[model samples]
Target: MSFGSFSLCKELQQSLIEQGYTKATAIQQQAIPLVLEQRDLIAIAQTGTGKTASFSLPMLQLLTKGTAATDNHIRALVLTPTRELAAQVGQAILSYSSLTNLSTTAVHGGVRIEPQIAKLQSGVDVLVATPGRLLDLYTQQALSFDKLEILVLDEADRMLDLGFVDDIRHIQKLLPIKRQNLMFSATFTNPIRLLAEDMLNSPATVEISPETSNLEAISQRVHPVDKNRKTELLIHLIKSNSWNQVLIFCRTKHGADNLVTNLEQVGIRGASIHANRTQHARTQVLGGFRDGSIKVLVATDLASRGIDLSRLSCVINLDLPFVAEDYVHRIGRTGRAGHKGLAISLFSDDESKQLKSIEKLIGRTFTQTLVPGFELAIKPIVDESDDDLYGNFEPDPTYLKQTQKRSKHTKSGSNRSRSKRR
Candidate 1:
């Protein structure tokens, strides 16, 4: 539906138009009005679903109509899991609220606290923060939640993954008991529900898609390569297919660096972003990637949740993700905002267990193709016995049969598919 139909504040409607947001996304269409009504909510949606705008657009108006905020006090709070996500959400807040006078600031770890202290000392109507850093600031008396009117937990599942449970609970306890609460998660796992029960007051729920689902616009394929030749295959595909820009996901920071080095050795422009990289370095890499100076951006799961490169069209899993949900997030970097994208995953026979788990979680099997020259050296051993490969993890017969049916469609040929990057 159109933004105008939402009865949004004129300034917000103007911001949406200036931002080229003519129509509200499903999440925005459903959640914005309820949020404006001050109802607690649980939003089940993925990154790049205009999730930031869904809440930011209406929250800006809510804060604008409410009492003016002052230094050291906050009217609204948005908690994210990572520094980059906090910055992205804070940037969204600023961009949407630009036409209004609402002050927005982001606070997170991996940066100095003193500057954030100064920002908070001057007071902010909206504060986007990482849970750990928020707790740190609260302990230092740099910020106060006494005036907090709305508390939003964006990507709440990621916070739990990052061990922010105690911080979330502590922050919950400090908020005004009557304040509004909103929680959004990629997957509403059991733990998230428990936390929601503690936070929400008969909240409304909106589910656009499950974390287990891949974007229909994303063409996903799996390349079966030996563990050692995976890098070579990646290099060959990049050169042969003329991939200008790609986001490569690695399981660890060291692996990300190693892949970048491998790409550089082959004369391909590559950069790496991970937890080990300094925030400055990470920012530089992201900036270059966005500007086309960096052809390949190798990163870990941290970037899976943080990076919001709408123009990125290709995502390569140099290795299978440790968690199935991470696979969804990695591919989510692309195929955003209704744009077509590609997701390539390279796995060896040793990674069969991971692949199986992922297939089960997503309830779909990927079309597995073998790159001609980089084909597997050793085939995975079949479970000859009746016991499950993963003990006690019984396979779903329907899913297993569906996987087998899909695998039969694999066509042996070149691995790379030519497509224009967004």
Candidate 2:
């Protein structure tokens, strides 16, 4: 379906055309009409599904026909889980509302509150914010929910993962009881359904399965390497494959920083984004990466949320996440907007549990391959005794089978010479 068929305002339709958004994504086609009808909705969508546009487009048209916000008041609120996501949602709303006079501003922590306060005091039609910062602004009387006509909880699952449930309930209590509520999540887990019951009123649900062709847009492969040699393997792949604009995921902030440092020492332009970094630094690094001045962007999973890079063709999992669902979100960073992309994971023996969980979740076994010199040095020991199953489960026959199969796919004789800084 096309944006024109959504019965949107002319300005929004024009904006969509100019943005090159011709056909509506499945999420957009399904959710936009519900939002336009002012119905409470629960959208189950994954990353890179044009989920932002689904709501933003309808919101722009709806807000254009409503009463304008007064000082210290907002007409609509979009709550996100991370600063990056808040900014991303805010930007999408702003971009879609370009042809209209609707005002939009995003507020989040890690930045000065005084400036956000100023933005809210002047009044905004749409306020996109993180949970904590929104509450802080509310406590300071910087914004009011009295004028709120619509409430959107974007990335509901991520908010729960980040432990924003209490804040969400608090914010809900403060909102006008008679208003439209929309909740969007990657999954409709019990926690999300419970939250939806609390926030939404007999909402309509729209779910786009992640196992669809959207996932097929990405080519996935695994490289079996030692834990310590992941950095070397990453560098080798970047140089050997001549990859540019790679987004690498690390499990910890310290690990992300160390990886960037290592990459820089070898002449690869790299940067890191994580919770520990100031918002300013994170924004600067993202800007550099988007402009091609930075070859690689290393980020923790939470920090990577809401990062939308159209040209990012590759994503590397330096360390697999403990949560299997995160694997889907990480690779979703690429293969976006129907573009073909690549996702590579550096698998180690110790991460067998994570690997197994991920394969089970995605319903596909990754093709394991070994880089010539970066192959594992010590093989994992298998405990065949049935009695020791629960006690020693790290190295089972499944892991050994995968490892043994990996040896057959090792690349031919090649130079092990590591790339150096030119």
Candidate 3:
């Protein structure tokens, strides 16, 4: 259905028209009406399904008709998992609220707090924030949620995965219980459901897509190569295909950095994003990648959660994620907003368990291909008996030795206690 059927404010309709969004996505269609009615909502939708606009539009309409209280108390507060996402949500609110008089600001860590405090004190109608920075501002009394009308948790699943549950609960306790509650995520796993039970109040549930599926426009494929040769093959693919923009996912911070170094050594423009990097660096890397100045962006799963890249052409899995659900979110970087994209995974024999888990999660096997010159000389064996492949891969000898030492100490302590008793 068209966005016009939602009977939004004339100015909002005009804004949508100018932005070239005539039709509503499935989640938008179902969610806009409930949100306009001022009901608590739990929206389950994928990454690129226009979930941002679904709530942003309705929120603008709600706030425009209401009056602001004294002390510039925040009217709406949106909590996201990452700084990039907070910025993106703030931008969306600003763009959609252009015709209105509402003011919006984004607060997150890895940046100066004085400016954000200044903005908060000046009065903001909507505040988008990451949990850590928000807590900091709250503790310093730089922000107040006393007049909060609506509370939105965008990407709730990611927040939970990032160990933000305690932060979310703390924020929830500080909010006014009467405020409108909204929770949106890509999937409703058991953990997500448990978290929703605590946050939502008799919410209207909306699920736009199947729980375990990625976008249909993305073509998934796998290239079987040796563990050491994956980076070389990645450079080969990007150079051969002349791909302009690519997002590569690595399992660790070191892996991301190493991938970036390798790509640069081969004459490809690449940047890495991880927890160790400052917020400014991450933002710069993301901006460059989105603007097509950077050819490849290597990032860990946590660092890449909030990245919303429009028309991103390709996503390469340099290291398969240990969790199956992450695979959906990784490839979701591409095939956004009805655009066709490709997702390629570089898999080695050691990662077969991860591959199997992903296949089980997505309910399909990826089509495997072999690179001509970089193919594995000796195929690595996969052991079906080991369920925890990621945990069992003891690559660090020092760590294993430490574990053994700890065990021996514990046994000796038990024997000494028995001898003393005798």
Which has the greatest lDDT? 2
Angstrom error of the Cα, residue 153, model 1: value is 0.2
Which is better, 1 or 3, measured by TM-score?
1
Candidate 1 per-residue C-alpha lDDT over 291-377 given as tens digits, one digit per residue, 9 for 90 to 100? 999889999998998988766769999998767668878898888876788999998877776787777756687888988887667
Which regions of candidate 1 are displaced past 4 Å? 210-214, 384-386, 390-422
Q: Please report, in order, the local distance difference test score of every candidate based on alpha carbons.
A: 0.81, 0.82, 0.80
Measured against the true structure, the TM-scores of the candidates, in listed sequence, are 0.90, 0.90, 0.89
Once model 3 is optimally superposed onto the true structure by TM-score, how far is the C-alpha of residue 154 displaced, in angstroms? 0.9
- The 10-residue segment of model 3 with minimum total lDDT is 413-422
Model 2, span 1-422: residue lDDT tens: 77889978888888888888898877888889988988888887678888899888888789999888888999999999999999988988888989999999999999999989988887899999999999999999999898899999999989998999999999988998888888888766668767887777767777665543257789999999998889999999998887778999999999999999999999998999988989999999988988899989999997556689765789999998887778888988888887888999999988776777677666678888998987679985544454533333232334234323433543311111111111
Off by over 4 Å in 3: 211-214, 383-422
Q: Give candidate 3's TM-score.
A: 0.89
lDDT of 3 by residue, 80-166 (tens): 998889998998888887887888899999999999998888668989999999999988898888889999999998898789999
Candidate 2, lDDT over the whole model: 0.82
Query: Where is model 2 more than 4 Å wrong at Cα?
Result: 381-422
Q: In model 3, what are the clashing residue pairs, if there are any?
A: none
Pairs that collide, model 2: none
